[model samples]
Target: MTATPVDTRPLAIDARGLVKRFDKTLAVDGVDIAIPEGAIYGILGPNGAGKTTTLRMLLGIIDPDAGTRSVLGASNPQDVARRIGYLPEERGLYPAMKCDEAIGFMGALRGLPLKVGKERGRELLEAHGLGHAIDKQIRQLSKGMAQTVQLLGTLVHRPKLVVFDEPFSGLDAINQGKLEVLIRGLADEGTTVIFSTHVIAHAERLCEGIAIIAGGKVPFTGPVDEARDRIPAQVRLETRSADGPWRAALPGDTRRVGNYWSFPLPETGVEPLLKALIDGDAGILSLSIERAGLHDAFVAIAGEAAARDMVTRGGGEAA
Candidate 1:
């Protein structure tokens, strides 16, 4: 006999046309997202790309000028805030406070009793490998240990939704692994996790879906596999494998780099190119088709968006 797996798809976080403006500057310009329950959804962008601003707006730290965002079915930020555990990018912990004190304070802020907060604090410190440093002051702990304390504090209230902003920053490889495990455990326990970071590689392993924002707008928002599928899997054939007419016969965005050639492939239909290469018979040495990685996709999409922004601004300047 086997137990049935629970269905975990629900709208944990939903936003439509979210816009946040500060004076004349639009920090977040009309973003929309639907994040499923128990899923890790990553928001990725470069510096000053409005990732932090979007998160703040969603957490009710700052109100959006236009559009609506809901966390856990409550369109009102204040109402949903109590059910959310948030770790902001700019971390703050009182240097004089002990690890237990800090964690208890965070839990108390989330409406837990002092005794319960203290007990949970001890458990988290141990779980995160900070048990030895539990009584130590925040100032005395190492940066990685302090980070662990902060992460534990966020989870104290058992919130259904957790928002982590650059959660892996300032941690060693070991600590990063620890954090990844903890995050996965949270999602497994039925918590929806959303995080924003500039590091795309971290998100590649940590998130099932990702929303890539650039210049205050989302360019890609879907499952990681789906996003990867949108880009062509390219193969490089670096050989002196043709006569002068070979350039024209090559298929789909082929470029000659040094003595080698790079070709961006269209999905399917590689038979024509394969036949041409064999027919040309000009000494083919090595041919390899590399599946387009997330970095390649990010650079392609983000670069295009940036170029468009530049052209738009250039036109305005000329006018």
Candidate 2:
């Protein structure tokens, strides 16, 4: 029987030992990220966690101090820039320029001829419900309309790789939904899409894999389910009798959150503890194993990094 080969070439977006320093301050420190092709990857981080810096480095807008990075197999930014589309967190649009003109300009920058760019711009605008805004100046459009225009411009060239930095920031619920659908459609069509967001719920909904970055570093990187699985399942106990000894019977790591007693599953088994709670006259109002939530995991990792940075800064200040 022939053995199947493990395909482990460098990922679609791979950064190895990436470091960025400005004077004495290090923004991104020895970060390594690997994003697969045709995947919706998210970089989940709070503001100023080097997420933007990382994205900038990936797109070759800025160079790293020490590392190798590539996008779509192109090691040089100039060579790869044509194949990648980026929507930066800071929305940049020529306010006085008409919507059609703005998008066409961006498309032209990506090497599309004027006629083709104009036609493509119209198609995208009309398809995205901006048909009437073709002649309207960006200054005359609402924030949502402007945002849609920017997004349409980013995709007008059909770049194989799209990087969105906080793309959903100012979008309301309705527009956010529209953007989500558009992003999903892009990924479904084989675009290697990656976006950065501080919103965990949005990441959970849109990303197949994610890298949770905090304090200028990535603490978690993998598939969403794999990340969740790395966190032990919590056994939740809700009892009518709050005064029961069942709390003490559980492991030391077990915690009381509100009325629920959460005990992490033991390496060996939880059956013994389950039986103990039953035998102890605990009402057992609810007994269930709760999988780790993405928010919970993000908090756990990000909080640790933040606390460590605080302690380090405190020591430096005292010295």
Candidate 3:
């Protein structure tokens, strides 16, 4: 049988050899990304890994020292700025502005008329469960509520592409869950969502494709499952007998700790091993296969040091 062809969707954001420098420091080096339209993509990395720099260059927030990019089919990102929405890592809103007004202001910035922005802002507020705060001042809301308002503003214009940088930062567990739902909802509506996050769990849960960046360079990029497949699936077996002829069937690398024997699943498949176990009078108590998680894949692909840095930062903004 032929293997399934990889995703051939049209590109929403195509960037190649993007390089950026801040004074003497090389912030991003030769980054290339092709995000398929309507797919949820993630830029995963540790702090100061040049994720923000790469994003800024893609959005035309900053010019790359080298390389090229196309945003929403336009060679110049600014030409299509109205069709894209961005939420930077640093969140800010005028404290004196009412919630609806703040959201409207954001929409207006994206070319929506002030009146229409206000109307849509109110509707967005209601839709996101922030209607009660529509008339309230930004200063009066809690941090999570304020962040939600800013996020609502980002969506009020209904842009085709949305980019969020460390969006999960500063959010509590419940708010984080809500944000995940909101992101999936955006994708369900055919919006292309690209988010930069050091949190691997978020990328694993939401991203169809990801670019793993470390030290201002991309170490790996592609489907989430492909990354996970870099590490082998592990097998856990429990048997009534610790030693028997069936033990010989276990892979040489198998380890015994207490009552469990763990090892990488055999290439020949489990059927042969099960047969040997049964024939050798080894009473199997239980067995399970555990697929490798994104965390393990991250460590293998991005290196242990980069993975440690990611864990150390844990959702904080990149330097």
- Per-residue lDDT tens digits for candidate 3, residues 71-93, read 88999999999999999998999
- Residue-wise lDDT of candidate 1 within 1-319, one digit each (tens)? 2464544677887888889877777778898888988999898777667788888888888888888888888878778676889998778899999999999999888888878988899998887778898899999988888888888999898999999988877789988888888889999999999998767778888888888888888887877866776677777777665565445557656787777778777445567766666676746687787777776677777776553442243110100
Winner by lDDT between candidate 3 and candidate 2: 3
Off by over 4 Å in 3: 314-319
Off by over 4 Å in 2: 1-10, 239-249, 252-260, 269-285, 304-319
**CA lDDT of 39 in candidate 1?**
95
TM-score of 2: 0.84
User: How does each model score on TM-score?
Assistant: 0.82, 0.84, 0.96
Candidate 1: the clashing residue pairs are none
Best by lDDT: 3
Better of 1 and 3 by lDDT: 3
- State the lDDT at 76 in candidate 2: 76
Error of 1 at 227 (Å): 3.0
